[model samples]
Target chain A: MPDAGPPGRRPRAAPAGRAASLRRQLFFWLLPVAGVALFVSALADYLVARDAASQAHDQGLLDAATTYAERVQLSPQGVPRDMPAVAQRMLLAEPDDRVFFRLVDANGIVAAGGAGLPDDLPDGSAEAPAFFDLGEGQQRLRGVAMRFEAGGRPFRLAVATTTRKRDRLMAEVLLGMAVPEALVFMMTGLLLAFGIRRGLAPIAPLRREIARRSHSDLDPLDMAPVPEEIRPVVAEINDLFARLDRALRAQRDFVADAAHQLRTPVAGLLAQVEAAERAAAARPLGAAELAGVAATARRLSRLVAQLLALARAEPGAPLPMEDLDLAEVVREGAEEWLPRAFAHDVDIQFDLARTPLTGSRIALREMLANLVDNAMRHGGPGGRIRIGCHPADGEARIVVEDAGPGIAPGDRERVLERFCRLPGAHPDGSGLGLAIVRAVVARHGGDIRLGESALGGLAVDIRLPAPAP
Target chain B: MRDARLLLIEDDQALADGLSRSLRQDGCQVAAAVTAAEAKALVGSRAFDVIVLDLGLPDGDGREVLAHLQQLGKDTPVLVLSARDGLDERVGLLDLGADDYVVKPAAVDEIRARVRAMLRRRRARTGQTVTLGRLTLDPQARRAYVDAEPLTLTARELAALEFLAARADRIVTKDDLLAGLYGGDRDVSENAVEKLISRIRARVEPAGVQLRVVRGLGYYLQTGDA
Candidate 1:
């Protein structure tokens, strides 16, 4: 109704592919969060498992060192010796680890076993055993060292073992903890998908409802059990249906009226022809006897043309725009109505300047033709009419002013409506000219202003925006 | 078939039947085709004086026929009949070599006039001059002379007079005169055409040529000898 102005600038009613579109949005928003949660939980599990394994491995190493120190014995010359192998094996009981033990006396002599071992053992007192990690290239070992009395001499003993079992325990913990979390994550993802699908379940029914309807069935869509989020959308669609129903109804009524309008003249034509044939038996038929038929036929032709022009001028179905000089369009108007004005005893004066308009040539022609016709109709006998197109504020200004009885300012708007004629106006008009003109001007997104002309009748001024350079 | 053979290509049966009946009553053979295919077959079968083509044919648009006619180099005058009142459609059809177009619910007389006009124009295009009484109209020269005396008339008077003279003894509707002179796109009224005829009539009536007015139909130019 508002000239379908800036068709491309209109906002979309709703986003397309609604359900899949929402899923895509949710996936982008939520997947990263779910992934981070999985990573954090897995990291916590690995850290706890590694800490517990290190503590347990260190405690076992200390116990093995203490037991070796306790079983020391003098070997005839008071050299400290380890306890029996079977007793040492009983104390160092670890299935997946290799154990080492060494006892060093204050004289720097190995009394037990220190063969091929690193010499960086921590010096310790009897009160506390020092547990430390020893690096053997890439492989790591945990060791415990303590000072103890052996064969009535103070000696330092250290026991060490590789961390292969501790690492295996941590790997077991990582897998054991992550599997359930991952399963839960997958379950949550599936549930989310199910929930989204369930939320959008109404779409299929809506589609089916729409598809099942006949073309003429313009009833509002059923909103039963529609999701709350989509209520506004369905309501909007229903509103559109209501508007369409009204428009169609109005169109049907108009067609009925137009049909009647057409029948009047056509019936008159047939009757006149029949009468003329009848008159052939009496007196010869001529223009005087067939005046009604001729007049109606001509009226019918103009009415048909006007009706078609009105239909063409509707803004809903827009014509493609083209760049043309406004001066050319004005000349077309002049060409159409100059003779008409002359016949009406009106003086048509043209004050021309070059102005550019980007519009459908036919539509602008219709608009200007109407303006000229309106002037010729209401410009009174012997009135002077002035028409022009000039540039103003980067817009094309087209105007028609006539020296006749102009309408009061209040009635200017009413005159533009369809079938609206002023009291005591000429009967020759179909009252559609201005309506078609307004429709065309509206479609072009141009402005129409009706005011008092300097020539004393009506001044119809139109301004259309200039196209891009 | 009569000498003036007309082919009507219209999808609407009622309108087609009515138009064909009226045209047939007017002493012309009217061939009514209900579809584009039928119309196409009918057109190629024999030459028609004029083709009243409806653009909204069931099988296809009538423009196809226009294209087909052009391709075949058949200069048969086509008068497009359409419910579409769009100027672009009318202009586009005319540009496609259609002689003219008439929007429907058109009066029977209007269609008859258009057919006659198209046929006349077609004849005129073949370099023919028309004679009514002693007044002879040379279309090529665009001149009119009454019994060897060249009449002094404006360009518009000559146009109106030429249209009337071509259909002498037959009625020419005022609407037809308006169309013939000013064309279909203009806003000139019937009064304008009437005024032109009277002015031309003032000069030609004394030259033994008589243009009789039928109020509903229009002027019938009768030769003094007739």
Candidate 2:
């Protein structure tokens, strides 16, 4: 049994390898997926911004190359004239960057302006100039090269600028796109953690309701606040509590009934002993008075024994089952009760057969004993009591019938209850015999029926399941 | 066996006192102990012919006393008395070397009779004659007498009488008598035993003895006034 800890204390930790926190599991499952999604989208945004920034910077280089190309004057022999220094300075003016230009003849000579400019011509016509990078490290520049014809000879013009402005623009786009996305990602993770905790909040009240209850408080838990997913679980717990409550009440009532039943015989025994003592003071106690005391003691002893048998036969009691022949159990019972039958002037006959079953020997013996006892009590003097055992319809059947007054059909069911004696019952009966029989029968998963016998008395028909073939 | 020494270890004060008084009246010297410790002390100090031990005791279990007696190499028979009447408990106690087990709430007469039976079994090699009231049987001679007068009986009748007399207070089944008299002879029916009992009853009844028939069981011999 799991320990139900004391009130106001946290429940003990679950056994190793079984601990599961739903809140942590949900957060763990959700947060990483959200983080990866945010990361992929942010990376795409950075790439798009970088592409747009480079396109704008390359367009400015193309404009500068076109302006420098217009300034060049070429002789008919295809020798390009150098640009005026003032005009060159005006075209290359810029802040935070240095600009360079070159006009090269088709022979690949350094025609004008700064040397070492890349002269890679565009694959398309001169109207569609191509952009390229030149130099290394901090001197890296973006340049565009184009071809033009003067006097029917091809000449190339190149313009390049240091890349500081383009680098600054890319950095701006990265800062603008990544910072807010990261904030949103962190915010979503926090919300997910909080949401999971709130989603699982209903379990707290259920736990508290259970922990706050006293041991004897077996009331069903209130289900209004329970979540839909766990309602079935709570309902099951409530069902168990209801069963426990019923069993507890039955136990309490049985104890009270037993006490009362025990008191009657004990009180009689004490009274008889006191009377005998008083009588002895006058003279020796008479044999009749002595017999009275003995009778009371015997009744008390029988009651105690019956009560023990009933307790042992109660449901959930440990029963040690073995393969046994029911006919043998019946025979033993008949032999044990034969003396009583003789005293009552009742004739007992047996029709025993080998009826094999799996059952507790002691309990089955007790059951048969009670049946015979009941038969004799009601069968009266000179009554014929018939006991039969055999296998019928895949079950071991035992029938005990008497030739005396039988119970009415309506009252048959009521007599199986503990201490439910019929009106005007024999004074000697403790009213527990049939109840013990019923309990034993029920424990063995057998069925019992009380009906009018062919002999004119009650017939207790018992059917116990036979062992599997 | 008249003055056999007996020890009774029971925790209930009133029960112990009453039982001891009754056993003493039955012609035995009975010593009483209220706890396991006291029982062990008494067992170590003296020899008892029989011991009636209750399983439940205040200081310890009655089994401890049984174990203690075993350690001392005492072979005195122990009759266990307990409220636990389960078959397993009875078998376990007997396996633990107890001579017998009787459930509690038992009649004092029953206990006395069991103690006497144990004593008789211990000395059974002598084959002592059994006497109940005026009816006595001399098994060695295959004879029975009432008031010291021998009654004429055949071999089968004598055997049946002796069997019933030996188990006087208990009801003997017809099968038990058949086995005792005929010893697996299938030709002899139970009806033959019934006729034999009637013949014995006719002779014994005039001598103030009864060969009582318990219907559906077997027979019991009631010696007059016993």
lDDT by residue (A312-386, candidate 1, tens digit) is 767467686778888767764453354345445676777777788788887888788887888888877787878
DockQ of 2: 0.27
Model 2, runs deviating above 4 Å? A1-6, A9-19, A40-182, A316-339, A342-361, A381-397, A465-469, B1-6, B27-29, B37-50, B68-77, B113-126, B131-226
lDDT, candidate 2, A234-261, per-residue tens: 9999999999999889888988999999
Whole-model lDDT, candidate 2? 0.81
Q: What TM-score does candidate 1 get on C-alpha atoms?
A: 0.67
What TM-score, over all chains together, does every model reach? Answer: 0.67, 0.73
Best candidate according to lDDT = 2
Q: Could you give the CAPRI-style class of model 1?
A: incorrect
In candidate 2, the residue pairs with backbone N, CA or C atoms under 3 Å apart (3 or more residues apart, or in different chains) clash, namely none
